[model samples]
Structures are given as structure tokens and as C-alpha cells.
Target: PWLPLEDDRVRRLVEARGPKEWPKLAVAFNETLDEKDQRTSKHIRDRWTNHLDPNVNRDPFTVAEIEIIRGAQRRMPNEWTKIAALLPGRTDTQVTNFWTNTIKKLARRALK
Candidate 1:
């Protein structure tokens, strides 16, 4: 689902399905947006943030990064495929890639 910028096929899929699938796309897009909103809201509500990483960068990962991992383990919602479908701008593949890459990165950092 990771639509690379170079990929024209997704554009075609969008063009072909966009108008017809507007409502469903909007639902998916909104779900993704909702998760994003949750990410922001959680950041505001979470007071124990520094308990994990005092110097956590205020990037997309800072809070969401950790929560995603925790969510994966806790299985509060659905599997990552469902989560991937709901991430704001990231495609399923992108989410998979983020998990694949960042999880390793965090693990490596933790080992030290």
C-alpha cells in the first residue's frame, strides 16, 4: 500500500476509484485522521511521557512511535494491518516499513 512517489498505478487507482469510492476512502482517511488526532490528544493527556524517554524527539514518533509499539503488544485494537490502514498519511506498506525499521532501531538503542 506504500505508494511511492514514482508509482503511477496508485494515481490511476485513485483516479479510477476515487470518485466512486469517495465515501469509503473518506472513511478510511478519516479513520487514519482519527488515529492521528488520538496521537495528538494522547500527547496532551500523557503526563508520564518522560518515563519512557526524557529526551524523546517531538517528531511523529515521539509519542505515536512508542504507542504504536505498545498497541501492537497489547492488542487493544486490531493487528498492524488495521492500524496501517488508519495511519494518517502512511500507506500499509509504509506503516509496515516504519514498524520494520523503527522497531529495530528502538531495539538497538535499548540494548545499550
Candidate 2:
């Protein structure tokens, strides 16, 4: 995780140079930070793509999305990444967390 300042810098860098330049951006970005706080290019890229990108939708999941997730889980079972691919602007972590925190709890209650 990054401090707000670091995250701001990353967003600025991506806006200026775009996401494809992550390796080069990571090198430049890391030079401004202490060694203990350095992040890999892939890590930075994943963070930007999955969480920090302006395009990510942070809205509550819709009913259709919930049904899609339920269906996807029935077919894929634990395939969070694959399920996430079916929903635009969503990440594997988000999908897994929703299932673990919400849908799974509901299913367990139904069985009881």
C-alpha cells in the first residue's frame, strides 16, 4: 500500500505517461522513495489497474452483477480472476471478497 502522496504521484505519472510504461515509471517513481518502501513495476501496475485507475467503478454491485457472480461461481468455483473478467471494472480481490463476505454468508444462512 502507498501513502496518499505516493498514490497521487502514481496517478499523475499514469496520466502523463499512461499505464503501459509501468516498468520505466516504476524505476523513476522508486528513485523518489526510500529503499524500504520500493514497489515492483508489476505491483504498481496491478495496483493502478485494479484499484487506483480513474476508470474503476467503485459503485455498489448491481442485482445483475450479483446474479452474474452467483452463476460464475457455480460454474467456476474459486476462480475469482475468471469471474472478475466477466464483470468490467471489477478485480479478483473484489469478487473474492464479495463472495466471502456477503454471498457465502447468505448461502450458509439459507442452508440453516
Candidate 3:
């Protein structure tokens, strides 16, 4: 059974404190809901992160920045952390997704 987490109780638990409180909150969620649908600390933390304003945490990559990411990726393929380090303000997931979604798609289109 899918337990929807958009309820007021879940929202209260998420907004109650910072990341440090996620583990405790996850436990609380288990107690409040069902033990079978247990939410991990990471799940709680991700929910908090997802709720944050995207503009505050992420920005669109400039052309020069994309070039930098491409160059770094060629040098160290699949090394997301290294690629992210080369591009300041970008997370590993951002870099990897850009490579997979944007860059790779561009390449495929060019080849076709």
C-alpha cells in the first residue's frame, strides 16, 4: 500500500527541525503510520531538500560552464564528484544528469 506523505502530520514532522532531526522524525513517522512503510533518514532528508527553493540551491549552467563540465567528463568519465568539483556550485547529481540528459542527448542528435 502506498502511504501518501503529503498529510499535515508528515509536513509538520519534516518542517519541525533541520537535517539532524530527520532520523528522529523518521522514527516518529514509523510510529505514527505503519512500521511496514518505514521511511529512512535519507528519505526524510531528501524530502526536506526537495522542498527547498530550486533557485536558491541551483542555477542554470552557462555555456562556458557546460564546456568545463564536458571537458572534465571526458578526462574522468562517470566520476561525478570530480566533475562537480571542477564546476563550482554544481552538485554531483547535477553534473551527472547534465552529462546523461543534456550532453548525451546533444551528441546523439548530432550523430543522427
Candidate 4:
């Protein structure tokens, strides 16, 4: 019998597989993030914060995820260091990780 991979098990496999496999597993992760809380979708709420809901993007993150990240940062214009100061439970280093990645991804898009 072909037992489809269990949810947590499949995601764990994906994590070990790395972002190179993100496209293949993105939907699963998004669904898990949605149902994880079973109240409202974390992915949806995050998209709201990222301004990419259906009222916004009509889909979850995509190759367009980078664009959505770029747009949200523009709407803030913070140093991210500053953003960390304003946010609870998140460090500047964390924000900086994303900030740097955002810039690199945007640069790649611009190069195309």
C-alpha cells in the first residue's frame, strides 16, 4: 500500500532537502502553516502583514514572494535594526537576515 508521507514527516523531509526543493513543497508547507493552528491561517495572516492576500496577491508566496517582500519593506523603510527594536520576540539579527536576503533577491530580479 502506498501510504502518502505523513504531514510532519513530509515537511521534515523537505527541511532536510533544503530550499532547492521549496517549489515542490511550498504548497504543503503553506497548507500546514494554515492548518497548524486550526483557528485562522498563519500563512494568510502573514500574507496580510506582507500585503499579499487575495485582496492582495490572490495566492500565497511564489517566485513573486520576493516581490512581496520587497514591497513590504518599501512600505516600512525601516533599517530592520529599527524594526527589531519595535517588534517583540524577534532580534535585529533575524530581521537583518531577511533584509540581506531581500536585497539579494531583488538584485537578482533586477538583473533579469
Provide the clash count, candidate 3: 0
Shift of residue 91 alpha carbon in model 2, Å: 1.6
Candidate 2 local accuracy as lDDT?
0.88
lDDT of 3: 0.68
Please, what are the lDDT tens digits per residue for candidate 3 over residues 26-68? 7876785566667687776665554442422466788998899
TM-scores for every predicted model: 0.37, 0.77, 0.58, 0.31
Candidate ranking under lDDT, highest first, comes to 2, 3, 4, 1
Q: Give the number of the best model, judged by lDDT.
A: 2
lDDT tens digits, residue span 1-112, model 1: 2224312322443455642443443443335345543222232112212222233333354466557656763674336667754445444444555677877998999999
- Compute the lDDT of residue 86 as modeled in candidate 1: 45
Across 1-112, the per-residue lDDT of candidate 2 in tens digits comes to: 5789878888988988988978999998899779989989988898897779887777888999999999999998999999999999888888888889896788889999
**For all candidates, what are the clash counts?**
1, 0, 0, 1
lDDT of each: 0.44, 0.88, 0.68, 0.47
Which window of 10 residues has the lowest lDDT sum in candidate 2? Answer: 49-58
Error (Å) of candidate 4 at residue 1 is 41
Candidate 2, which segments miss by more than 4 Å at Cα?
Answer: 107-112
Query: Model 3: how large is the Cα RMSD against the reference?
Result: 4.1
Prediction RMSDs, each to the true structure: 15.3, 2.6, 4.1, 14.1
Q: Which ten residues in a row have the lowest lDDT in candidate 3?
A: 48-57
Count of backbone collisions in candidate 2: 0
